[model samples]
Structures are given as structure tokens and as C-alpha cells.
Target: MLMKAALMETLLEKFYKNHQILHKESFMLNQQNMKIFTQSWRPYSTLQLKGLVAMVRYNSESSWLFELTSVAIAKAGFLVCAIDLQGHGYSDGLAGHIPNIEPIVSDCIQFFDSIKVDHPKLPAFIYGESLGGAIAILVCLKQKREWNGLILNGLMWEISAKFKPTWPLEKLLPVAAFLAPIWKIVISKPLASKSYKEWKRKLVVKNPNRKAPGKPPMATALELLRVSEYVRRHCHELEVTMLMVHGEDDVVCVYRSARFVYESAASEDKILKFSKYVASVDW
Candidate 1:
């Protein structure tokens, strides 16, 4: 029995060794001198490296499931790296507060550029989900002709009517934001509940780094609306190879808005895919 157990342990170790990936985590200070959490994954197999992929997570999401996605990409022969935006994950800032997106965009650019310095010859791709999609677009715009490809999953081109503030509240948002930047505003439903399937929702909420599901801060909500409009105005300038995937049933970020951007974008090689019954993070 002892011999059999030893053999089983040895076989398990061999299996893991064959499939192992190099995963690392670290902290970097952004321009604002805030500590930002960063992670990277590289496959240990003998396969030739294909390219580099930089991932950006949506608002309120950290490195939880995002790390799983990164590992999968790494296993496919690409070096995958991701960063936690300020105010989210293990980063240092006011929790869930993003008053201005430009700084965050700058942070991503700085980190990605640092990584690219080590692999200047490899094709680089930027992948963003939800709000991160908007950030990714901004990043590409800032560094025009730098990235090889851009992938947006459930991009938040426009906040869904089902999710945004209602009539009077929408009109008064600016005033509220000005008066109380940190005050949380009421929304229709918790984003996690609407964005994930049952099992996935449970896993998402279980994340210790995840901010509690509720209304976003008044300032953050206002800034997001403005950011959406900004992206709409600039999307036509996008020339990188692009792939956009959105769920037809997503109520947090409108699918129609993604279609509009897909049509407007100047990328000669762009594909837009619509899934039947997917949600925000389901892709």
C-alpha cells in the first residue's frame, strides 16, 4: 500500500510538471505613486512563444477569474500579463473610485510598455473585458499603431438603459457627483447578479478582493458615462486588428452599442460576434 501511494504521488507530480505554467505577482508604483498589483503567466512547456497578451479587467473585478483566463492564454503559447487598476484589487486607492480614467490608462500604458521592452519583437495584443474594454480602447488610441491586435469582450461602449440611472436621476447626476463624489448611487440591480450565471456568480462574489456588489459611487458613475461618450467619438480612429464579442442578453453593457462601434471602427480586419444567451462576463 505504501509503495502504491508513493507511485501515485510521483505520477501526479509528473503530470503537473508537464502542464505547469510560470505565474508571478508583484507590485508597481504608478505615476501617482500608488501601489498597483500586477501579475503574469508564462507556459513552461517547450512550445515556441507565439506573442504577448495584456489583459485588463472590468470595474470591481480583480485578479480572481481573470488570472484563470490569463493562464489559459499563456498555455496557448502567449505570455499573458494583467494589472489591477487603481481603487480595485490589491491596488492602493479609494476603493471602487475612479474619478478620472486618464490616469488609469496611463498606468496600463506604462506597465505594458515596461513588459514590451523585454519582448520588443513579439506581436502584442490587448484584451479587455467590460469597463476594461473602454480602457483598452483608450490605451490603443494613446499608442496608435503600437499594438498588433485588440480584443474586447462585452465592451462597455454604452451603459444599458436597464442599468443606467433613470430620468430625473440621470439629469441630476452631475450635481450629485459634484456634491458627493464618494456617495453610492442607486442602480436597478447588482451587477454581479446580472452579469454571471449562477455558479459563476457565486464564484465571483466569493472573491475576497471583490468589492461588494452595489451602486457605484456618484463620481465613478458619472465618469463612466462620460468615458462611454468619449470612446464613441474616438472609436472610428481604431485601426488595429480587432475582435469584438458581446452577449445578446447583456443588460449592463448594451450589445447594440458594440455593433455600432464595430461598424464605425476603421480597422480593415475586424470581426464582431454575437452570442445567443450570454451575459457580461459569460464570454
Candidate 2:
């Protein structure tokens, strides 16, 4: 029994040591003056590396939740990296607020371009979750023919009308967005309960730092609505190799939007996958 215990202890020690050697790091990336929080995990191998994957997280969430997924991808022979966008997680700005997504897209392009210089030979892929998936598509559209591939998990191609603001409020959003952009209006129900399955929903609730309130700021809400429309109009412009996987019954992002993007994109190598239960990949 003592010998078996010792063996287990040795295995645990090696596991942690290997994890340490995987070259994981968290640092602040300066996009102009905005300090974007970023994290990365590199495979602990001397062999030729596969590629680099840049992760864009779902909205209203931080990079912390995506850390485990990044590590897993790194272990799969790719250098995996993720960032907390300006308004979310440890980054600067108000919680869950972005008046414009173009700046956010610019920040990603700058960060990824800087890193790619250090890794010139390897192909780079963009992986996005929920709202991040929309951001990834826009990024690819901005820099056409640059990315090798795109992987979207439960992407927000079209937000369900159930999440939309009510009649009078929807009509007032234009002026409200301009006058009081920071006002947190209840547009939809709480996403945590709808986003995950039962057991995983409990885990999300237990995350102390998670910004559970799904309320969107006046301007931010307006921007998301506009962004969704813009993505739909230009979906046919997406020409990169792509794989989009979605849950059949996702209430947060919906399933039909995923199907629309898969069918609309110009990419010949695109694929759309459906699963029994789907939610954010950051978990």
C-alpha cells in the first residue's frame, strides 16, 4: 500500500512539472493605452509544432474561463492564446460594454500580428466562442486571405428575437444609445441558465468572478443588434476554411443562425456540425 501511494505521488509530481514546462503566461497587451489582458500556453515539445490558435472569448466573460481550453489546445501540439477584450475580464473599461466593435477587432489584429512575427513558419487559426465567433468572422473579413482557418463554437451569427429589447424600448434605443449609452437595460433573460446544461450551469454559477448579469448597456445592445445584421449581409464574403459547431437547442445564440452562416459563406472547405447540447466553449 505504501509503495502504491508513493507511485501516485510521483505521478502527480511529474504531471505538475510537465504543466509548468508548457510555457504558460499571462500578460497585459497594450492596444494604444488600453491594457488588454492576455494568456497563452505553448506545447512542451522539441518536435515541430503544428500551428498557433488565437482564441476570442464570448462576451461578458473573462480569459480565466478559457484558460483550461487554451491549455488543452496547447497540449494538442498547437500554441494556444486568448485575450480579455477591453471591456471584459481584467481589461480596462466598464463591464460588458463596447460602443463599437471595430476597435475590438483592431486590437485583436494588432495582437495576433505581433505574435505571428515570432512564429513566421506556422499557420495561424482563429477560434471564437459566442460573440467572439462573430468578432472572428469580422476579423477574417477585414484581413481577407490572411487566416488559415476559423473554428466557431456556438457563434452568435444571429441573436434570437427572444433576447431582443421590447417594442418601445427597441424604438427608443437609437436616442437612448446616444444620450445614455451606459444605461443597463434588461433586454433578455439571464444567459447563464439558458447557456449551459444543468450540471455545467451550476459550475458557471459557482464562478465567483463571472459577470452573471446579462444586461447590456444601451449603446452596447444597439451595437450587437447592428453587428448581427452586418454579419448576415456579408456572410457570403467569408472565404476562409471554416468549421462551425453549434447546439441544436442553444437559446443564447440560436441554431438557425449557425446554419445560415454555414450555408452562406463562400468558403468551399466550410463545415457545420450540430450537437445534442451546446454552450460557450470558454467553459
Which candidate has the top score in TM-score?
A: 1
TM-score of 1: 0.89
Each candidate structure's count of clashing pairs: 0, 0
Give the lDDT of residue 207 in candidate 1.
Answer: 65
Please give the range of 10 consecutive residues that has the lowest summed lDDT in model 1. Answer: 8-17
- Which residue runs of candidate 2 sit more than 4 Å off their true CA positions? 1-23, 26-31, 60-62, 212-214, 281-283
Give the Cα error of residue 245 in candidate 1, in Å. 1.2
TM-score of each: 0.89, 0.88
- lDDT tens digits, residue span 20-41, model 1: 8776789999899999988888
Give one digit per residue, the lDDT tens place, for model 2 in 172-232: 8889999999998876655555776787667667665666555778888888778888999
Name the top lDDT candidate.
Answer: 1
Scored by lDDT, model 1 comes in at: 0.82
